[model samples]
Target chain A: MSNDNEKDWPLWEVFIQSKRGLDHKHVGSLHAADAGMAIENARDVYTRRGEGNSIWVVKAEHVHASNPDDAESFYDPADDKVYRHPTFYTMPEGAKYI
Target chain B: MELNEALFQFCLRRGDDTHVLSHRLGEWCGHGPVLEEDMALTNRALDLLGQARNYLQYAGQVEGKGRSEDDLAYLRNERGYVNCKLVEQPNGDYAHTIAKCFLFDAWHLPFLKAQLDSKDEQLAAIAGKAVKEATYHLRHSSEWMVRFGDGTEESHQRAQQALHDLWTFTGELFETDEVYTTLQQAGIVPDLGPIKEAFDRTVNEVLAEATLKRPEDEFMASGGRKGQHTEHLGHMLGEMQFLQRAHPGAQW
Candidate 1:
């Protein structure tokens, strides 16, 4: 059964965490009537093979995005910020988690 | 029947229910109300079919008939099969399908829990795997029941009507026979008293949350366990077994 009231409910971007330490990585997108339905669909679609320990679904529309049109100018400034990279500081020889 | 033979029949009935219901759900594969719902329904169908394969194979082994799972499944006639009439009922609508599933899963979850104590270790092990799937199915169906029951004028009407139509079929789930008795007495199966009790509570809670009234206990259809089924099953089996019947021992 479907809640067909919404002709096109909305698109949801599915994210799945394969294990506890892993991030909820974006897997794919599906259309669902609500958050509950979205999460349910995501579980069936992306995690059927025990591929995920956790799931996170966000409305595709709700996610903020940066304009690719401004790619030349917007990200050019960060390209020179070498200190922002952790590689700028040498890790201790004994570092593990780092 | 001897206890082992009784248990074999019992397993066939249980597996039959899953097989028939899975086919009904499979009918909704491409025709679901929505794309996601379509996938979801087929996903459930696949799950039920997986369980059916395991249970039916065990039943075959127990019968000592040398029949493979496919033989028992595809070769069985109407009288040879034993599944509840509720499952054989048509997928009238989304609401009807959900109601059917809600009722079945309510009983299945508890039934599997009780099966965890069965003297039959293999049955208990299968139940261990099945109960988890049943839990998720219950959650999904219960959510839809509430959503449809409380959603809108149209949804409420459809959900209520579906419940009323399907209520009569729910009684057969608790039906008992000599085989069931033998199995239970032998501890190969659990008493269904607690299973029925749990089902009642679940149906009531979901109906209450959905603002839907439970239909009064009036007339309940029975006899499926005796190989007496509604007209639906014959038609369903015709479609389901056509390929195998036409091409005996055909391999995919």
Candidate 2:
């Protein structure tokens, strides 16, 4: 579409859940006229080979994320925190929840 | 016509409707107004082609003269096909195409559902699978129609115009002649009277929601079921059949 005539549709992010009890993983993105069409487009584009059991779509502008410029300050502090890891815990034999 | 011949003819009409409509939808391969819409339309086109293949394959078995599905699809001349005249009409604009598909999809859903009760096992099986697809096709096209009908001033005008222009072609879909009458008598096909009524109810509901008037029945186009079609179908067949005709039996 020309800039003067046709306005571009908004971008939407797509997420897909392959199985029950699993989180919907982000697959890719597509452009759609609305949220309804976003889901339809996501299904047609990403799930044609039966790659998903459920789908979630959100307008790209709605998503909030950490600033990439502050990545070093925001992430470097956690890297030295070995306590965040569960490596010190010993597995009880056949402990299902652990 | 004999019952067996009538059934064969009936199936051919159903198959031809899918074939021609599929071809029209295929014209949107890369020309869609949007990328997602392009895929949506072409996927529906592919669905129609799959249904056409099933119908034509069964039609060939009925013919029993060793004609394969490919032969029936690619070999027949224009007049031999019995698709409804509505499907062969051009995909004029986006709204026009959506209006065309919305009309057909709305009618096809019930028609295919009725076919699931066919006495013929093969036809029943085909319809059983096809009805599910028809449901989805109806949803997709009808939703688009609603938006186009009520969306912007320009979109609303375009949609109304498309419906007005295409309304004449809608009548032929439910036209029952000797072929259908014979098939219905033999329990091979359902009575289209109730189906037409059902189609009318659904169409009226959707059109009302869209805030568009059902165009008054003006001049109605007919005769594709009798192997007559608009000038477009001939050109469509020539292009669709060229490769198959030129390279007979050639495959990778």
Supply the TM-score for candidate 2: 0.93
Model 1 C-alpha lDDT per residue in residues A1-98, reported as the tens digit of each score: 44665566889999999989867899999987789999998988888789998999999989999999999898899998988888867888996645
Model 2: fnat (fraction of native contacts): 0.56
Instruction: Name the weakest run of 10 consecutive residues (lDDT summed) in model 2 chain B.
Output: B3-12
Choose the strongest candidate by DockQ.
2
Question: How far off is residue B68 in model 2, in Å?
Answer: 0.8
TM-score of each: 0.93, 0.93
Model 1 C-alpha lDDT per residue in residues B1-252, reported as the tens digit of each score: 788889888889989999999999999988998777788889999989989998999998998979988998899999888999999999998999999999999998999999988999999999999989899999999999999998989999999999999999989989888999988888888888888889999999999999999999989999998999898899999999999999999997
User: For model 2, how does the per-residue alpha-carbon lDDT over B20-107 read when each residue is reduced to its tens digit?
Assistant: 9999999999998887888888889988999999989998899888988888998899989889989988999999999999999988
lDDT of 2 at B152: 91
Mark the regions of model 2 whose C-alpha exceeds 4 Å error after superposition. A4-6, A81-83, A86-98
Alpha-carbon shift of residue A86 in model 2 (angstroms): 4.1
On lDDT, the candidate that comes out on top is 1
